[model samples]
Target: MNRRNFIQLLGVGAGATILSSTLIGCGGEPHVELFGWSGPAATLKDIRLKVLSYAILAPNPHNKQPWIVKLVGPSSFALYVDPNRLLPATDPYYRQVHIGQGTFLEIASIAASALGYKANIHYFPEGQYGNKALANKPVALLELTEAPNVKPDPLFDHLLNRHSNKRSYDRTSLSPNEEQLLQTFHQKTSDAELVFKSSAQDQTQLTGFLTEAMAIETGNKARDEETIAMFRVNQAEVEKYRDGFGVAQAGMSGVKKIVAETFFLSREKLEKNPAGFGEQAVDITHAAAESTATFAWLTTKSNQRIDQIKIGRDYCRINLQTTAMGLAQHPMSQILQEYDDMLPLQKSFKEGYGIVPNDTVQMLFRLGRAKPTTHSPRRTLDSIISV
Candidate 1:
């Protein structure tokens, strides 16, 4: 990628090439074929549906698009967490689930902007739910009003292009100018603290922390099965479910993905006996950490329902911003999760890194240059919308 595209990807200026659904926003990469990557179809005449078509592309934990919409009026809707679709094992407090909700909202708002509509959002319309649990209350109520004077969001150019890259990086570090631009962009977007580390000592400590965190996270029966249940074993399943992830989302492609699926990967067998699946998760997590040269994180003063959702929005925007910079971004947040068995390690990590005991490290991710992976699939928008 050129330096011009690199700076644009980091949101330094306004020039960006709008992409069609077939393009993965990687500048010169091959054309992609995922329906979810496509923009609002020509057939989507309704304004609300058009915006929602893009909202479904929002990234979420483990590709579980945990969102439910109740159409409230001709131009508004209520958003809720799909109680049935959550990562209770890894996200024991539904923090990541709420973050997913924020990502969906951010995408919808950006889509609305590109089409001359202002998305008016009201959070927790009924009442605030508990910080650590799910409730029936709607997450937000969105009202769209046409705004002829509104400028299209530049981030919209990257809607279909943005993705969570999950492959080996090229081992390049961000220049001082690039890092400063990112820090400034993040500070302007949210109040959360943005921390970037790229030293050799930092990499050694973090890769170890991340590798051990994955081991602890996947060392349980329920947790391993939760991930396996969502694993699409092959393309047949990828097209069949139109959701979850497989080798494609993990940076495997063509013959490698095919061979792995045919010979080694079996969803049914893994689901029944998931011990082996955890081993792969550990290996992949450690390798991903070692492959990258830079790491960043977001932390907040407290952990509440609203805080999680707000940070989710912040995290999603940072992901998009990185995409614009002609760089690859991936979240390696296994060590940031809140679970009993993982607390000791989490505490050690925070203290070692100078994060205060009371503060919550909401997001932890690796960043570098790498080839983009296939977009994670999404079920039909109708599946998420309950009339």
Candidate 2:
């Protein structure tokens, strides 16, 4: 049967019926409240919420926005991990989640600086925990204090524009000076080592590792389901969830988005059988990796919870710095994931790069020029507040 007939017949049942409207609705570029970023300065209200307004926009894995804020005082709040918002299948160690906590904290600090306040973040306030385990401890105890002389962070200006660009790059490398600027742009808040692999041979090998890693990642049913659960199939889903990613975030637009959503994309199909989706993901990963000419990763000497969070802060700054330089950056973290299936490739990748055996590679991503992709949506501030 043709796609139309198949869809109509499937519509008779519950699962396929919902796709009718969502399929066509995906074509329009509706104004989503989540994508419209009005930073803390616009509200001028509660200091906690004001700082949080921008903090919610921090780059996170799968756009999960896995953070919980509890109001501790008039000017203070505590950040916790929303255990529900974790990638257990892909990120078994909760390392990425803690990293996400770090990014959130970084953005909150920057927002406070821009708003004439200093955000003092005390890590693991209730006490630290093991990186391999999740605990009831607070990730950070943040206090917002008035500081009339606070200097706004330069990266703060790029907050609204910084995004994880996923489109194929222009196949170019950064100049030696550009690389030096990145190498030297260390902030006092973080001490992670930032390493780059942009030489012709390094790029080729890293690209192969990236593509193979993705192939391994999508080869599992549970892993594919974990990812598809967070995938917004259309614009309606985007509006309904106000989080997660969609074709638009993949840099699909004009005819590309319409074609995918109309003919190929369907949530029901992906949910029922993810093998096809997995294959497509691998293909896309290969294409994206093959076209890129530069790769970078962050490493830390230890794998403590504090170390992961600190690395996250540094990654956030690099993302913002690259944005300021008109460079597009996208994180390809499949090889770095801590899942069982990915460990072998992970080991080989680390050894091949001559990286320290004990050091943790916190983040691995590509950097080059590409058109801006859609900004991943963020949930409402109310969604992340602890009652």
- Name model 1 segments beyond 4 Å from true: 1-31, 35-38
The Cα local distance difference test for each model comes to 0.81, 0.80
**Full-model lDDT, candidate 1:** 0.81
Superposed Cα deviation of residue 94, candidate 1 (Å): 0.4
Assess the local accuracy of residue 127 in candidate 1 as a C-alpha lDDT between 0 and 100. 87
Give a tens-digit lDDT track for model 1, residues 139-227. 99999999998887788877776888877776777777888988999888799999999998888899999999999988999888888
TM-score of each: 0.91, 0.90
Estimate candidate 2's alpha-carbon lDDT, on a 0 to 1 scale: 0.80
Instruction: Please name the candidate that would achieve the greatest lDDT relative to the true structure.
Output: 1
Residue 76 local lDDT, model 2: 94
Candidate 2 residue spans exceeding 4 A from truth: 1-38, 41-44, 187-189
